[model samples]
Target: MSALAEKADSPLKKKPPSWSDIWLKNTKPLKHVVFTMPLQSLSPKDPKSQTLIPTFANIDRTLLLSDELLLQILPKLPHLQRNPNSLVCKRWLNLQGRLIRSLKILDWDFLESGRLFTRFPNLTHVDLLNGCLLSPRDSGILLTHRLVSMQMGSGFCSNRKFLEEDLLPVEVVDKGLQALANGCPNLRRLVVINASELGLLTVAEECLTLQELELHKCNDNVLRGIAACENLQIVKLVANVDGLYSSSVTDIGLTILAQGCKRLVRLELSGCEGSFDGIKAIGQCCLMLEELTICDHKMDDGWLAGLSYCENLKTLKLLSCKRIDRSPGRDEYLGFCPALERLHLQKCQLRSKKSVRALFRVCEAVREIVIQDCWGLDNDMFRFASVCRRVKLLSLEGCSLLTTEGLEAVILSWQDLENLIVVSCKNINESGISPALATLFSILKELRWRPDVKSLLASSLVGTGMGKKGGRFFKRT
Candidate 1:
């Protein structure tokens, strides 16, 4: 044993005390004394003691985050709720001003109060569907210099209480819209549905910066008001008035619009009740028209024949146009649309095979065709697809006379075809589908048909032989 160990253990010879004894002897004040007598080490046997130790007051306060950092961390937080920054702390309140540049509150009563709008001054685009009681003055207040686009719902004009009590007659609605237009000088697009004629005129006059205007369920006076927009590029007119009768936008109104909007490229006219004269006027005035859609109106082959004059026309959609009879001269009219790329004919009663052949012959550049619920289409029409070299997508749904043989002929001829949809055609079966599938399996991306479960499973498991992977084949239920 060393000298230190021997002194710690010795009981005589003035042995130096151990470290623990020295500490006790050196201490001056002692509150209590404890004796360490040998005993069994006892501890509780509870299972929780072996589990995780419980802790209190473990909150960490050193990580203080700033609002700017929080906003940078989460930019899409405002889209989750209406005025989300308002609910956050005052530090986040300023974020609402920066984020709410485009506000679209549709039919939510909570947003009806103008308080939300007043809170954010940077709003540039707003769409109010319903729930707000906006007076003419209130509407003007909402239109600021920053606002560039605004869409007010039909409810604004249709409210019974506003019409009877609050509204300032038709003249007042016009003045309000005009005021809004004048306020937002940068306004580019405006859509007001179910408003009065005077209100429409107010919009045309005040919103001079408008490039596109859509007015539905209006009157002839409103159509006349559209003449004020000299720079308008696109116009949509939907008339629905009771007891107020007017000529179906005769040449007089159309001539005025065409002459005014020289830069017009696209025009959509539905439920106009106009004759071929209006269409002729469009053809004569708007020679630069690229896309035109005329639905639920009366138009004969003469009107279509006039459309051939529109050299720039690329897309033409005629829905429920029953006046276009399938006559021998129909092909001559179809020859006019040379630049046509897409043609949509729905429930038009197109029966003649020559008409179909003429359509394909005239519109040689057609890449897509949709013929739904058209009557009198037979094998001859199906055979016409063989000549359509550019056809990529074809939809023939509800064409009862179309059979698998016709589809097979069309599919086999289409080398560049990508998509083919035949819905509710009872005559089409797997035999006709399989041949085309084998030929264009590589290029084909989508095939929709109603086939048996076994055939569908087999087609899915065993691909068609086109030197490429097979595409998806959906079985209609």
Candidate 2:
């Protein structure tokens, strides 16, 4: 075939795809893709070929790093590391949330419901402020709180006080529980105030590892919910929601709790009444019960009989406990807790020698003693404290009946006393501060009776006001 004729007959070849087309297919924004030459070079007739197109000179530095690398680096960098593109990528933002092992979310308005677990995955402990948790494991967060109390009788009508404490910033409804159940799979410890039965049940069902729980004014449903927590070791039942009526927790709920939570080791009941049955149930079932703290409630003097059953009980703390039996020679009926080791009484009524002896009758293994605001207790009560050879630490605060001579008598007899704290003891005046007491103070590891100790002994008369203020520190070594 002739060359000219053959060329005319041949089909035209297709142009290979250009860099713009290839790069544009893979890149996020086509505007970011640039070429060395202007488009006019390909089409000679274009009028604007002489003009130059300026490209963006700088690229975002973060965009250069791979998503995996960014995830590892983001947590190490401070929160405000780079403000420009903090959460440019969707996946990276989600990953950043998982790095948070501990968090306190004061604002529910900001949190998206049902995403709590995805937001914080490694959190082992959670505290709800009218809030709830999603799943995280292995990592734990610590929360320290004061033993905030109200003046002894100030809260008798202190319904207003309860409003501030037990009420949630926002009520936890069904949707909230549904979100929590789906999200918090590894929750180990939780403290939620005023949570309803459904919410409580959902947590027990979903958070299988839950060991510690604190709730206000529990009922049957709440107990049913907690019954499901097979690993529960610590429980604090708050009964002082002044505005709210005491529920079935006092007796029925307590019985169920004792029957259900057999693994319990520490239990605290505040502002609770009608205690013998409940206390007996706990002692009978929770053999592992080690520490029991009861405050601002009446358990009848007979409640001590039930507590005698807790063979493994180690520590007993009674604050403002009522029903003192000053009847003489009832020491036999005073009850005995052989395993008892540490005793702490604050603002309790120890009006008679029998009352004081009855309370201490069970403190056989007593090593540490803290007596505060027990005005009725005089030199006679100190005699009971003197007998415990295992006693190492002693703290006396607001004991108006205690004089310098009584302290001397007791301190001299205590064979193993290591630390002593006397604050606000009215009767122990300047004349009472003998050279011997000063010499004794010098030998101890912790001696807290300062020279200016101005008799806080009247704290009870001034009233145990509500809130965290107006209390002396009791350091446990």
Candidate 3:
């Protein structure tokens, strides 16, 4: 064999390191450089001359990428980490501003000076609560503005006069509203406190696309401005939420809202006092209305009869209500809502057997029923629900007074039931599950059963301004 061939066959000889191995072992860090096109023209006459030199510029790598590319990359990072990138340069700051669609105003000056618009030009949703709820710097408290406000009012027990003192002056909020109107013409949603009629009018004129609005301290006079919003669809009127504000939005405001905003799809009345006439007007005027919510309502007796007017209402939610109706009148006169598909009762007082039965009668056609954390809902009281024959879904939570027999009896009457959820019912133990109920459960398409789940003790604290508000969770306008 040749000498080279003999050496190749030698097992004792050490092999040389591969190029990948050498590259992997190198610990020196790499420096990234962005190359740009030449800006200066070359000297043709002295092309080879040493006197004329070529210069390479060091530039920001981010500038080379288009705004479209940067936007795609920035969103992949968490918002907390992504914030630092905006401080890098003016380009990044502007790009980051474009990404923000919602903002909560704490400083009224921020909105009044036009800085809000210049900074967040694309904002579609804005909350002016913090601005209106601002407290004097001299107050000297460690708690946040909202927490301080809540404590001052003593939770939901605060009277109207106390809340009035906490709110900002009307004119100050009006200036900020005007600024918001001029800048955010595409604004779709807004949450504001104590805005005057003129301020709201300005917003209505400018923000023609406004759809959802949550108004605090709303009154009959202020609703006149809102009526001008032709595209307004969803509205939450807070006339006198216990610890929040004091002014009342009565039947007059409801009538004005119903007549002017005929395109409304969803409406919420909180701490409002209205009778049958106002509700009848709403049902007659807002033909597109599909959902209606009444929280801590102060409507007079016999108002429950007015629900029959809402022919298109598909969902009726009663939250933290003390009573359905003091006097719903004769069962024949208390007509039912024909299109209602879902009836939701949470943290409500369902003690009066007559009112409870009337409520069940009004929602007789409901396909789904949810009863959660309601007081005075015993087996006898729940028997009233048997009138709802079309119920296909039933969920019961935090109903400590409800026994297994009560639920089983009501569900057995609902032959069309497909889904059942029973959770956190202290009285509904495993031993209470009857043979018939087990058979019915086996046939259900979906069932979530946890009868031993300790009833939520805090459910009773709802509407007391103790827990997080639902509006903050919704990201979409």
lDDT per residue for candidate 1 within 1-477, as digits (tens), equals 698889876787576669989777756543232222222223335645532333223432322666566556556654666365566555556665655555554332333334444455444444432222234432433312111222223444332333123222454445445554544455566655445656656666766677777655445555667777777787776542222212254445566677667677888776555544666667777777888877665334444455666677888877665544344255545555667788787877666665566556655677888888877666776687677788888888787777777777776777677777776666665545564455454456765544322343244325543221233354211
* Cα-based lDDT at residue 24, candidate 3: 62
Candidate 2 lDDT, 378-424, residue by residue in tens? 88778777667678888888888888778888787676778877777
Best prediction by TM-score: 3
Candidate 3 least-lDDT 10 residues: 468-477
TM-score of 1: 0.61
In model 2, what lDDT does residue 394 have?
87
| Runs off by more than 4 Å, candidate 3 | 1-57, 66-73, 76-78, 136-162, 453-477
lDDT of 3: 0.81
Point to the candidate with the largest lDDT.
3
TM-score of each: 0.61, 0.67, 0.79
**Which residue pairs come into collision in candidate 2?**
121-136, 135-183, 135-184, 151-464, 424-456
Give the winner by TM-score: 1 or 3: 3
lDDT of each: 0.58, 0.66, 0.81
